[model samples]
Target chain A: MEDLDKELVRRARLGDKDAFAAIYEHNLPRIYRFIYFKTANRATAEEITQEVFLAALRAIPRYHDEGFLVSSWLYEIARNKVIDFYRSKKSDISIDEELEERPELTSTDFVKTMETKIEADKLKNLLKKLPEDYQNIILLRFVEDLSNEEVAHSLGKSLGAVRVLQHRALKALRKLVE
Target chain B: MTKERIHNLFDKAKEIKPSEGFLSRTRARLYEEPLDHPRSQFFFESLHFGATQAGIYATAACAAAFIIYMSSSISVNEKQSVAMKRTEQIEDYKIDVTLKDARYYKEVAPNVFVVVSK
Candidate 1:
């Protein structure tokens, strides 16, 4: 994996379009899957995924060979992008608080919408029950499929620390699920 | 019934693949962005890479300058203290004027008072 990344990076440094394409192909699944879990909806995930790739394209050049595992580097970048998205989104909600103006619903298709809304609310509440750090860890580990080592590298933590956090995070989620 | 449901939820979440057209749309966006060659490639890299190097250099230079500055000040202090001690020693001498005045008076008034040399 490291070798392939190095190869792509080398080609990419030389401004090889196909190499960049190869990187995109290799990474899109991981990026998309990670984002999908953060946002439980499909459309938002897709938009964030697009933004991730665009960001990657813009950032590929300054990547140094400071023993950075490329996948971890990419994962870190994606993590930051996701955080930025959520921050912007949260701030936007605070701006107008426009959603509060809606009256009691009388529209058709309301039952299905209400069901999804309830489930979403329940899921969000369960997510909130975990510490923010644990939530981030679980999202990266189980949902993003990044290895503990990768997560540690991305988060700039010791392997033991990441492992401990992952353990605690899984336990916390188990409480929520059960 | 168990925590497996959440674990399974995560698993199911992973299995929920993106739509098939995802890549094509991605490719379109990719192409729309300059592939591996854009003005920003230079702007971002030069700005970031240059700034990192500059920061490290600046920190090291400042440290060196501080050391040099401190050592020079210490030596100056040492020299100043030595000069201060010398000034103190020179200033400690208090000359008495009585003996010299008396000698002059005797020499001028020899007719009135004889001064014997002892």
Candidate 2:
């Protein structure tokens, strides 16, 4: 998978639209999922996800491989975009408030089945209550199943730090669940 | 909830994804805009390379100028020292000749005085 990503990135760097499309297709679901969990709104998630890809498209020409996965880089961009989204809003609208306001819109096609939608929403709400780093650690480490090294690179933290954070995040999630 | 239960919940959340419509729409929009031109990338790369080359050439030229300036100054100093030494030698030779003439005149004068007296 890394080799494929490297090839696609090389082609994309050379202005290959198809290669970039392949990369976008491969990473879109995870990126969108990450953003969706963060914002808890479908429209915002979709918009931010598109913005992340657009930013990636613009920046790929200057991208040099630094021994990390392309997905890690995309996650970093997605994380920043989410932060920027909140910063731009500058409103006191908490995640709970936003979720309540857009209750009906939270269900994406991926969660169309009633049982899965409820489960996903419950998990997302619990995730939103955690501190930002803990939320990111949990989402990227468990939900996305990224490797520890990948999570560390994506979050700009050390491997040991990621491990410690992961433990703390899980403990906090357990408290929320209880 | 137990750790296992939480893990199970995360596994379910993994199924969450963006809608197909959103994915296709985003893809279409992205591709419609176009990727950066390869020519532009090459141009910028060439510009960077040109800058580096120019810097290297400028440094080499400066070094060459300094070396030439230093070597020429050293040679000029050597030439001046040699000229000064030659002048000193010439002056010493003149002084030696004058002393020898004075000695000869003194000796000849004494001899002439003796003849006159006799």
Candidate 3:
């Protein structure tokens, strides 16, 4: 998969519109799904997802391997766009001396995101019964389909720390499930 | 959660497919729009001759502006000093002229033009 992605990336980088179209067709859903998970609003998610691909198109010539996956890079762009959207929304709330910090995704936000995930749908109210950090770990681990290493990398936690968190998260989830 | 339960959810979740025509539309959009070259790369690391030339021009313009600013500052200082010197010379000339007039009057014989108009 990585090889195929790289091939498309190379062609896209070289201005091959057809090859890039194939890549766009292949990855748009996954990308859209990722963005949808983050934003939790269909309209906002769709906008940012399209922006990510457009940004990737513009940045293709300058894209460099920064020890990050192309998808990760795309996600980073989406993340920034999401942040901007939230910021714009916040400004509309009322004028103030300083902009409010992005409302850190509360348990409510998590539930909104996981409302569709497997047993999670039936377990929404139950999931909230778990601790925030545990919920964070479970979401990143399963719904996000991130590897343990990738989770650690994304979270800036050591492998041992992530492992410990995962253990605790699963135990807590089990209690909720029971 | 039981494996059976987990598998049940997974299977059901996976069935909630993404929108149809998404890929086709995206492909058409991708082909419809040509890729753009990022402009910020020139700021970070650009090798284009045009970009390099723009950098060189910017550097040269900044350097030239600095030189002009410094030269103008120096010229202002020099003009101020020159003006001060001229003022002092005028004062000195006035003093000299006073002294010369006194000497010329003193050198005149006391008897000369001695019409005592007491």
Candidate 4:
């Protein structure tokens, strides 16, 4: 994975459009999922995901051959983009807006939607109720299936610190779910 | 929440996928953006590119001229100091000696000879 990322980034640095697009495609799901959990709004998540990739696109030239994975760098950008989104909104006003102003559902469609997506929807709302750090740890660890070391790399924390955070985050998440 | 519930939640969450058309739309946006090129490339392509490059060259020329001016001033100061030291040496010479039919008077000041060679 590291070698593949290095090759992709090397091509990307040299202005390979296809290479960059490949990077975008490779990281899109994880970044989108992260943002989706944070914002709990598909539109906002999609928009922020776009912003993250564009920002990454613009920054690819300045990327050095530091031994970090490209995914790690992408995650860092996603994290900052989420922060900027919140900072600009001043609160979760958009989340509330999305919940409040969603188009009314027909009865037949409502039942279908609930049956299919209820657990995911509940998970999103419960994840949002936790503190930001706990939410991130839980999502990255369990949902993304990143190891503790990978989580530490993305979060810039020590491995032991990540473990402690993961434990606390799971505890907090349990409380929220109950 | 129990550990089992937590696991179940994560399992459901992991099933969440991005909406359709995301890849195509994003790819279009990427193609539309000129982000693949370096900023300086655009800086050179824009109308202001020439003007900015010319400005940079002109500033470099001015800097070169300033350095030359400083060095030339320093050289002039060096010459003046050397001349002053010559005068000081002349002030130190007070002895006059005549040897082998050549008379020597040490010069103490300009146009005042302490040593005269004949």
Which candidate ranks first by TM-score, i.e. highest?
Answer: 2
User: Across residues A48-154, which tens digit of lDDT does each residue of candidate 2 receive?
Assistant: 99999999999998887988889999999999999999989844333333343334455563245456657778888898789999999999999999999999999
List candidate 1 stretches off by more than 4 Å. Answer: A66-69, A90-125, B35-118
Could you tell me which residue pairs clash in candidate 2?
none
Angstrom error at residue A26, model 3: 2.6
lDDT by residue for model 1 (A104-134), tens = 3345534544454444445445766887668
State candidate 2's TM-score: 0.67
Residues B1-118 of candidate 4: C-alpha lDDT, one tens digit per residue: 3888878878877766665466678878987888657666644445364687799999999999999999999999999898777667655774354543123222323443455344
lDDT leader? 2
Write model 4 residue lDDT over A1-178, tens digit each, in one string.
Answer: 8899998997787677899999988888888888888885777888889999898888987987668778878888899999898888744444333323334556785565455357777888887778888888988889998878778888888999889988998888777767
Say which prediction, candidate 1 or candidate 3, comes out ahead on TM-score. 1
For residues B1-118, could you state the per-residue lDDT of candidate 1 as single tens digits? 5666676666555544455577777887787776555566646755776799999999999999999999999999999898666445434532233666546544543333323343
DockQ of 2: 0.30
- The clash tally of candidate 1 reads 0
List per-model TM-scores for chain B: 0.43, 0.40, 0.33, 0.45
**Which scores better on lDDT, 2 or 4?**
2
The parts of candidate 3 lying over 4 Å away from their true place are A66-69, A90-140, A152-161, A168-178, B2-11, B38-118
- Tell me the deviation in Å of residue A120 in model 2: 1.2
